[model samples]
Target: MTNQIYPCLWFDGQAQAAAKFYCSIFKNSKITADNQMVVTFELNGKKFMGLNGGPHFKFNEAVSFVVDCDTQEEIDNYWSKLTADGGSEGTCGWLKDKFGVSWQIVPTVLPKLLSNPDKAQNVMQAYMKMKKFDIRELENA
Candidate 1:
């Protein structure tokens, strides 16, 4: 047996909306539970519960979901879906959804470049040139 902790996100009456949005963006994703005040969903096999715990708290960048994508198409797809509605884009593939949930939609190769001493600056340069990540650009950089 393994012990793992999942994130339970608190929302201001938008738990269901968040769950649906997330499920639509990810493959093999679905909502496991739905109620007036709570919704549970799985994204890329990681489970999360969204709680409609009223407007007492708001989501911030202190915690974020980092989506590692393999291709530019995947990155674009996620970025477009997640940044829809009132969401805003931030630097380095970071975005805040309509519900103020922070997300980082990055290419899977980013870690490889960042971890490589020789390619770190080139990768950073590529990242700086993009509002959304492009794997081809990073690879060429």
Candidate 2:
């Protein structure tokens, strides 16, 4: 294989299904390749490879994909779609989908707002109370 950096996700025989689901959620995404052993796909221009490695490996929150949003509507849209159907919510804008992959849906302005030492605490406090980030609240903080 060529030397290239890409996230290789392990799935228990659900690589293809996971790739399709992810493609449906993100724009400019598609499955580039698929077979019995592996599935390659792209999300927002980033490439990922999913391996049908079976149940020997399982997903955990130690690694997560962060989806940055520019507006509350965008945040809401991602939150709803990602947490739909058997997904569960976690604190600080974290969630796990049906496949057990963790995701962090956050506002693009979050880092900027939190970068200010004076307002960082307030912004963090506001985000702590929210499952889905609210841009207005962060700005007010």
Candidate 3:
């Protein structure tokens, strides 16, 4: 037997809206099921459930979804879409979606760049000043 684990996001009566919004952003994503209380969706083939769990709890930076992008365009796309509407940007490529869910849009090469002790500090410094990750700048760093 195998176990499949997935994340369930709590929403304030906006499960359906949030699910639709997310589906619109990622390619090959869709809402699998929806109801007054819950909405199940798949983003890029990963399953997730959103519950209209009320205002008892809210999303914070303690937990965040990380999107590792291969290119500057990919990072820009996610950063722009996720920060649209009522969403706000945070330091170091972190941003809160309109639903207040925190997400990190980062370049896939970030780990590789940071792995080198010689260039790690420079790369970190460069990214520290960036809201959206710039792949070229990191490569240059």
Candidate 4:
């Protein structure tokens, strides 16, 4: 048997709506199924299932979807859109969308920059000060 792992998002009642919103944001994404119990979707080729499980559970920062972008434009684009409407921004590129799902919009180079021993502290300092990530600033740090 082939084993596969996919994230299942728990939603109070907006599973389909949240899935649709995610699909609209990422490339190569789509809604594969929708029904009273669940909504299945894909984002950037990753499969996700959203369950309309009721008010028993809610989303928090413990788990978040991270979006890694190659350019500042991509980062900005995603950050702006995700934080738009009723979404609120958090420090270090974290945010919660209108549906209360957490996300991190980060540049692809962030990890590499932070991995450098000489620059790690500076990079971290710069990163901790911003709501959205800026690749150039991190690089400069």
Predicted model with the maximum lDDT: 3
**Among all candidates shown, the one with the greatest TM-score:** 3
Report the candidate with higher lDDT, 1 versus 4.
4
What TM-score do all the candidates reach, one by one? 0.90, 0.94, 0.95, 0.94
Residues 1-141 of candidate 2 have per-residue lDDT tens digits of 588799999999999989999999999999999999999999998899999998998899999999989888888888888888898999889999989999999889988988999999999999999987778988998
Higher-TM-score candidate of 1 and 4: 4
In candidate 2 the C-alpha lDDT for residue 75 amounts to 87
A best-first ranking of the candidates according to their lDDT comes to 3, 2, 4, 1
Task: For candidate 3, report its TM-score.
Answer: 0.95
Looking at candidate 4, the ten consecutive residues that score lowest on lDDT are 1-10
C-alpha lDDT score of every prediction, in listed order: 0.89, 0.92, 0.94, 0.90
Model 4, backbone clash pairs (residues 3+ apart or across chains), number: 0
User: What is the clash count for each candidate, in the order shown?
Assistant: 0, 0, 0, 0
Question: How many Å off is the CA of 114 in candidate 3?
Answer: 0.8
Kindly indicate the candidate among 2 and 3 with the higher TM-score.
3
lDDT of 3 at 141: 85
Poorest stretch of ten by lDDT in candidate 3? 1-10
TM-score of 2: 0.94
Model 1: per-residue lDDT, tens digit, 1-141?
A: 378789999998889998998888888899998999889899977889999999899888999999888888888988998899999999899999888999999888888889898889998987997888878888878
lDDT of 4: 0.90
